[model samples]
Target: MWEVRLAKHLKADLGTDTFDLVQVPTPEPAAGEVLVRTDYLGLSVAYLEMLRADSRLPIPPWEVGQRIGGGAVGTVVRSNSAELAVGDLVRTMAGWCEYSTGPADQYPGLDPDLFPSPVHYLSQGPTAYYGMSEVAKAGAGDVVFVSGAAGGVGSLAGQIATCRGAAKVIGSAGSQAKIDYLVDELGFDAAFDYHDGPVLDHLRELAPEGITVFFDNVGGEQFDAAVEAAAPGARFALCGALATQIGDHEDRFPEPDLTAAAAKGIAVLPFSTYHTPEQVAAWTEHFSTWLSEDRFVFPHTIVEGGLSAAPQALVSLLKGSFKGNVSVRVAS
Candidate 1:
């Protein structure tokens, strides 16, 4: 067995402050499994929150020195399943590691034909694909508002909405820089800062007619604002709650004003991208096509180093120190 598995671990306090980087023995994939050489590990605001609040997610305790990050891109070094081949570049849920072993079925949507650049496929492919098809339900004539608009998912979601014929696309971000980029570059009708006073107030001014479709990436106050500003007969897609809960702060999930939604006949549908395998496949198809055409962009923040840097990187991502999808380069 090869040794030296440096991994990031989330400890008892559930804060990045307690994270540890340690070494272990590498293991081989069993039957039906594949061993991969990790290249990049994707981080999410939601995942960082879950790391801070271990009780909030459905995952188990972080083993003494097990990896804590998830969503990675890697090359298959060994494969026991026909679905994957050695040297195949793929994306998987395996976290901050140089190498990992898991069932081939655990990862999906890896293009059988290798891409010109494997890193792009690993970081943005699944996230963009998942958000457009499942989270947004993008279609023509819909008015869509995407929060965290410059993010990996939000950027793709915005483009997908436009392609589907949305009448107007509005987005919210953390900075004026992002706001300008969303409108001038990403085709949003209007973009505003989340901290520019109250979101509801700004949204009301921009969308006097109200939004017909709201794709929520930042929950908490933003979610509340969506509920209040929804047009009659609106379709609300609740994809992520990045703002409300962090670590033990999950109980702070903003109470939605359902009364207003009911009065307007609005429909709220909250879902996770990982809710089903079929959903993942559906997203992958949409993403692959859009990505090939350069219609979607996946904004990312690459935190250098490997597992040793995961804790700080995750903390920075959760604190909004960096914009877009956050990832750590674990190998190569």
Candidate 2:
């Protein structure tokens, strides 16, 4: 079996040279665990930042050559639990390697039957589900705005808001094509190219009345603009700061213009999807229902190259080269 594991926390760059891809004897499933032959791995911004030397997460020296951690969708080549079968395709927080092993106890909520065969569900599904269902609390007839609207979580956030009955869902993307896709396919009420000009100006024009909710994925300028354009009493869900956390860069959140937010009595709160497995399970059910019912849709940015390409894909995703959830195709 081939595995692409991190050599160490990288500082200069994370392209081909940063990892160690080696052929190793495949390990079998341990008791209460499952061994998956990974087909797709999600490249997340959090992991990208963690790959940096000054990362908030300190890496253990002994584990310096370990596999990069995140989520993957794959087929169960071997399983010890009756809940999972040999061909079951499932999603798990495994790694960027071609195969992964983890305890089944941690992922009790996901349907084991959905694995090995590619279902509509993947990395973006749960994120869209949890962010909107829990943090954003978006509902039908509400007007919503999502920053970084073309990225993985942002794209799904927009769609989930739409599915929940938002009267108008506005999305801000980096490119015109992404904007078009949002409006034409994803059912956004309005879409804007953030590069065009001031985000606040564009948002005000689109949402002249006000916005009921703001699901923000990118921080920095977008956060500032969302604060400025937020409708009175708006629910501001702070999910990520992709724009601000670029390449060894960091920025502080500006002091809330209390006067501005006070005008609307808006609520600005930050949340992480890693709250609890119980929460993930509940949120997954909600989003999965929407997905199973065809009420929501997501776009995946897939780069096929197996595990060796994992490092570059992570860099491209963080640099905004990929338009949606970055996935590494390991097989099929």
**What residue pairs are clashing in model 1?**
52-247, 53-247
Q: What TM-score does prediction 2 earn?
A: 0.85
Per-candidate Cα lDDT values, in order, are 0.69, 0.73
lDDT of 1 at 224: 76
Backbone clash pairs in model 1 (N, Cα, C under 3 Å; residues 3+ apart or in different chains), count: 2
Which one wins on lDDT?
A: 2
- Look at candidate 2 and tell me the lDDT of residue 4: 74
Question: What's the CA error at residue 251 for candidate 2, in Å?
Answer: 3.5
Candidate 2: pairs in clash: 88-115, 89-115, 89-116, 90-115, 140-165, 141-165, 232-264, 233-264
- Predicted structure 2: lDDT: 0.73
Error of 1 at 225 (Å): 2.7
Q: How high is each candidate's TM-score?
A: 0.83, 0.85
Clashes per model (N, Cα, C within 3 A): 2, 8
